[model samples]
Target: MSDIDLDSARPIFIAECRELLASMESALLRLPQEADKDRRDSVHGIFRAAHTIKGSAGIFGMEDIVSFAHAMESVLDHVRDGVLPIGDDLIALLLACADHLGQLVDSVAENQAQPDAELVHDARPLLAQLNQRLLAVRMQRSPGAGDAPQRKAPAAPRQTGADHWHISLRFGRDVLRFGMDPLSFLNYLQRLGRITTLVTLHGDVPLLDGLDPEACYLGFEVALESSAPLSAIEGTFKFVMDDCEVGILPPGSPVADHLTLMRERARGDPAELQRLRAIWLHCASVAPEALDEIAAAATKPAPAQPVPAPAAQPAAAPAPAPATVRARRTGPRPGEASTVRVDADKLDRLVDLVGELITASASATMAGRGLRSAALQEAHEALALLVQEVRDSALQLRMVKIGATFNRFHRVVYDAARDLGKDIALEISGEDTELDKSLVEKIADPLTHLVRNAMDHGIEPPALRLAAGKPAQGTIRLNAYHHSGSIVIEISDDGAGLSRERIIGRARSQRLLDPGREPSEAEVFALIFEPGFSTADAITSLSGRGVGMDVVKRNITALRGSVSLASRSGQGTTVTVRLPLTLAIINCFLIGVGGSVFVLPMDVVEECIDFIDPGANDYTELRGQVLPFIRLRRLFGVQDTPPRRQSLVVVGHGSQRFGLVVDRLLGETQTVIKPLARLFAHLRGISGSSILGSGEVALILDVAALADITRAAMVSRSPAAAAAEPVHQG
Candidate 1:
C-alpha cells in the first residue's frame, strides 16, 4: 500500500482555503435578520456553508480553520434551532469570525501552520460572546430549553447493504502525472457505498526497470456493492472518470471472457493457461465463458468495452521516459462523461493564433482568384469552409456566462449596503447572458462602481421609503441580457428616484450647466458623473468622493461600450451599459466607403437599406423615425471616388438605430478584431481592425461611438433649444 503523500496534500490545503473564503463571503452577504420568519432556513444555509469548509479542511487535517468553523457553526446551529437569535450584533460577531477563519485558512494554504499569535487572541472575545449568547438564549427559552433532551438526533445509515459494488483497474503512467491518486477512487467509492472488497492488480506490474517510481504502473480491479445507489458511484468519477476505463461488470461474469482475458495475460503460454484453468474451476463460481475467453483474448482482442476518457484538453506533450518503464493506460469506455480539464489561457492563445490564421487564409484564398481553374476554385472553396469553422471555434472559446461576474457583486452589495445601514436587496436577472472573457474582466470594475453608486446615492433609507408609501426595504436590481450583438447590463434602484431638482441645482452651481437653460433631466443627471461633481450633503470615503464616476465612464469607453442613465422622481434610476459579446473576431457584414471596405460587427448591423436620395423629407413622416444617419465618406475620408449609388447600413444600439452611407455592400465575411495599437486607440468610431482576403486592413466601426457622433450632429443642426431632445431614457 502507498503511504499518504504530503506533496499531494498541499493542493487540498489550497482548495480548502479557496472554499472557506467563498463560503464566508456567501454567508456574510446573506445573513438573516432576527425577525425573519424563515430565519431557520437562513441559519441552516450559513451552517452548511461553514460545515463544507470545515469538512474539506478536515480531509487535509487543517485543524485551525476546521476548529474556527466549528465554533461559528455552533452559533449557527443554535440560531437554526431558535435557541439564539440572529440579531445585528450576532451577525457582526459571526462575520468577524468568518473573516478570521478566512485568514487562518489562507495561512494554512501557504504552508504556515503557526499563524500570528494575535489572530487567536482577537477571536477569544468573539468566541466567548458567541458562547455566552448561546447559553443565555438557551436559558431564556420558555420550557423548550428544559425539553431539549427529548428531541431525537437525525437517523444514521446501516453498515452493510446489497447495492454495494466496486470497480478495479490499474492505469498507465500517463494517469499518475495528472496528479490523480488511484487511492482517491477508493475513498470516493466509499462515499457511494460500504466497499465490500478492494484488490490490487499486481498482475499488471512490469519488472523493476519497466517500473516507474513516479508513474502509476499498477492498477486496481475493485468490487464495490452498495445500497446507497449507482449514480453516486458514477458521480465520483465525474471529473476524471473518463481518463480511466470504467464499466459495471456483474459478479460471476462469463468464464470464457475471464479465460480469454487470462489467456491473453498468459500470452500463449500453455502451462500458464492450464494453471489459470485450474484456478477458475477451483473458484467454483468463476464463469466457464471467462475461462474459455481468456485463451481467445490472447490471439483475438477481448470483447469491446467502453473506451477510456481522452487525455486532458489540447493533450499536453508526453514526457520522455525509458521505454521499459511504460505508463499505465486509462480512459472511459466508449460513451461516458469522460473529459479533461484544459488551461483556459492555452485556449485563448490558440484562438488568437486562429484569428491570425483566418486573416492569412483569407489572403491566400484571394490570391488564387486569377487562376480561375476548376481545381483551384474547388480548393479555395474548401479552404474557405475550413477557415469559417476555425473562426467559429475561436469564438466559442470566448463565450462565458455573465453569471460569474454577477456572483462576485453579491459581496459588494452586501457589505456596502450594510455599512450604509440600508435594508437594500440586490436582485439579479439574465445571469445566463454570455460575453467575451476579456470584456467580462474589464466590465467588472465599472459594474462595481455603478452598483456602489446606486447603493450610496440612488437607493434611499428604509424609513424614508416606508414613509413614501413603499416597502420599508429598498431593492437594487442588476440585469444582463442580449441586445443585438451586444450584452446590456442594467443596475437599477427603487430608491427615491434620483433627485432631479438636486441634480439640476448642483449642475448649475458647479457651472456644469448654464442658468435658466432648462436642460433635459438626462443632460442634468449626466453631470453627476463629471469629475469632482456630487450633490451629496457630505462626502464619505465609501463613496461621494467624486472620483469613481469618471473612472466608470472611462473604463466602459475603453471597452468600446457605452453607459446611459435614466431616472424618474419617485420610480427609480437605471444605469444601462452595453458591451460587445467578444472583443476578438466578429461576423461582419462588410461595406465599402469610396471603394474601401469597412466591417460593421454583425451583431450590431440590423439590416441594409438601399438609399433613395433624400429630397427634404417631412419631419412628420419620419419624425420619430429619422434614421440617425452618418456619412462614412465624410467620417473616414476614403480616397477612392464614391459610386453614384450608395447603400445604408442600418446599425443598432438597443432601441436606437442609425444608417451609415457606404459606396458598396461587400457581403458577409468572418473577420478577426485586431484592436488598434495604443497610438491609434484614441481614434473616433474606429474601434479595431480586420484584414480582408487581399490583405487589406479594414476598420471595425464602433456603432456606439458612431451613434454618439450622429446624435451630437443632429443636436447641433436642430432649430430647437440645445436641451430639447430626450437624452436619458434610463
Candidate 2:
C-alpha cells in the first residue's frame, strides 16, 4: 500500500479530538445534576469519547495521546461499569485529565510528535492517581488483589478456555484510494491483543494484467488471543468500519458458528465456501468433527418450535449481534443530514468573492440606469436581486450559533467558583442566537473577562447572600438575542449590584468626575470601564487588577459595537453589548451631505423627514419628544453650500433615537464595508468606508459613536438642555 500522508490528516484528528474533549468536559461538569438514567448515559458517553480519542490517536501513531487516553478510558470504564462511584473529587480529576488531553492535542496541532518533557512530567502524578483508583477498586472486588508483591503483577486475561477472538476483515476496494493502509489497522489492533493465527485470502484478486495498484483486494482472518472485551476489539476498526467489513466473534464460540460465518462470507459459492472452511480448519486450528456436527444440525431440522419472546429469554443467553452488522444493515436514519468541514479561510474567500460580485452588480445597475433602456434596466434589476441572494447565502455560511461559545464558560465558571469559595451557578438562555463566526472568535476574550469579573467582583459569598434573604447560590445569567439587525448579549449577576455611592466616590477621587457635580447613575456606572478604575476593597487574582474591563470595552468598540450598563444598587448589574450581525457586507441607506456620501445601516434607519428648523443647533422637538441631531456638514467639515431643502434621517440605536441631517436623502443599497486606513482610524462618527456604484467612496456612519457624540455635545451646550433630553433606558 502507498504511504498515507499523515500530515494531511493531523488537522482533522486534532479538530475531532478537541470536539470530543469538549463534550467530555461538559458531561463531567453536569454529571452530578443529571437524573439516574441520564447519569448512566452520560458516563457511557464520556467513556466512548475517550475510547474514540485513543483509537484515532493510535491510527495516527500519536502514542503519547493514545497512552494517556487509554489510562483515562480505563478509569472511565470502571465508572461506566458501576465499579467506581461518581463524586466531586472524581469529576475534578477527570476534568484535569480532559484538560491535559487537550494540551496534548494542541501539541500535536503544533506539529510535535509527542508531548513536551514538561507535559510528560505533568502526566506522571495524574497517571499514578488513576492507577491507584483502579487498584483500589480491584482490591475491593478481590480480597487478595492488592498484596504488595502481587500488585505489580499484570492483569490476568478473562477466563475463556482458549482466550482467542476471531476477527474477519474484508476491506473495500477504495480504502487505499482514501489514504488508508490495511496494515496500519492491523498494526494498531496488535496493541489490544496478540494475533496467534492469520490467513490472507486472495480469491477476490484479479489477474496480474488486470490488477489496479490503488485497489485493495486482500482480506484477513485473524485469531487474536486477547483479554480485552468484544467492544474494545471492535473499536480498533472504528474509523474504517464504514468502508470495511468487520466480523468479530468472542473467544470460545462453537465450531458451527465458524461454519455459519464462512457460509455468509462465501455467499453460496461452493468453491469459495470450501476454501474458507479449509483455512478455518487448518490455519485457525478448528477441529474437523465440528463440520459434521454443523452438517447434521443443518440437515436434521424437522421439529416445530414456537419462538420465545425477547423478554422471556434467560439472563445467561448469548449476547445480541455486534454493532458492525447492525450498522451496515441499518445505514443512516431517515432525514439525517450529512456535513462537510471546510476551512474558515475558504469561507472568507467565498465571502470576499461575493462582495466583489455585489460591487460589480451595483456598477452594472448604475450603467443600465444611465442608458434608460427598459430591457437593460429589467435585466439588471433581476441580476441585482440574484446578487443580493448570493450575498446573503455567502454571509450565512459564516454565521454560527453562539451556543458553542457560551457552553465553554461552564468550565470557566466551575473552575473560578472553586477557586473563589463561592456558590455560583451560570444560567444561559437564547444560546441558539447566531452571529458572524469572526465575531464569535474575537468576542470570546471580552466575554471571558466579563464572566470572570462578574464572578469575582459581582457575586457575593454564600453567607452574605443568605443574610440578604437570597438563595445561598448566586447566579450569573448569560442571555443573547437579535434586535434591529444586531446581536445583543447580556451578562448579569444576582449579587450586590454596583455600589452607586462608592462608584461616585471613586470617580471623584480619581478625578474622572466633577467633585461638586452629581452625575446620573448611568454616568457613574460608566466610569468603571475607564482605564485603571476599580472599586474592590482588596485585590484578587481574578478581578481587582482593574485591567480587563477597559480592554473589553475597547475590543467591543473596535468591532463596531456598543456596551452599556444598568444596575439596581442592591439588586444586580447587567451589562448589555450590541454588535452588528456581520462585519463584511451590510444593507445601508445612502445619503449625501455637501457632496459627501454617507451610509447608514438599513436596520438602524427608522424614517426620513424634511429637515425642519434648519437653524436648530443640535437638538430639536419631534412629535412632542426632544430629538437630538448631528449635522454632517459640521461634523466632517464638508465645504459646500446647504441645499434649499435638506432632510433629517431618524436612526434608533438601542433605546436612543437620533437624527442625521443631510443635504439629500438617497435611497437604500447593499454596501460592502471596507476598513479605513490607519491614517483615518481615529476619526469619530465613522466606522468604515464603502465604494458606491459611481466609484465614489462613501463613509459608513457609526451610529453608536454618533449617539455618544450627540449626548456629550448636548451636555456641553447646557445642563438645562441635557435635563430636557429624554432619558434612554438602555
> RMSD per prediction, one decimal?
12.1, 6.9
Candidate 2 residue lDDT tens string, 587-686: 9999998878999999999999998863756888788777888888989999878888889898899998888889988899998999999899899988
Name the top lDDT candidate: 2
User: What's the CA error at residue 559 for candidate 2, in Å?
Assistant: 0.5
| Maximum-TM-score candidate | 2
lDDT tens per residue, model 1, 13-118 = 5665565567656655666533464454456557656766666565555566667777777677666666675676777787777778767766665654544556
Model 1, TM vs. native: 0.67
| CA shift of 471, model 1, Å | 1.7
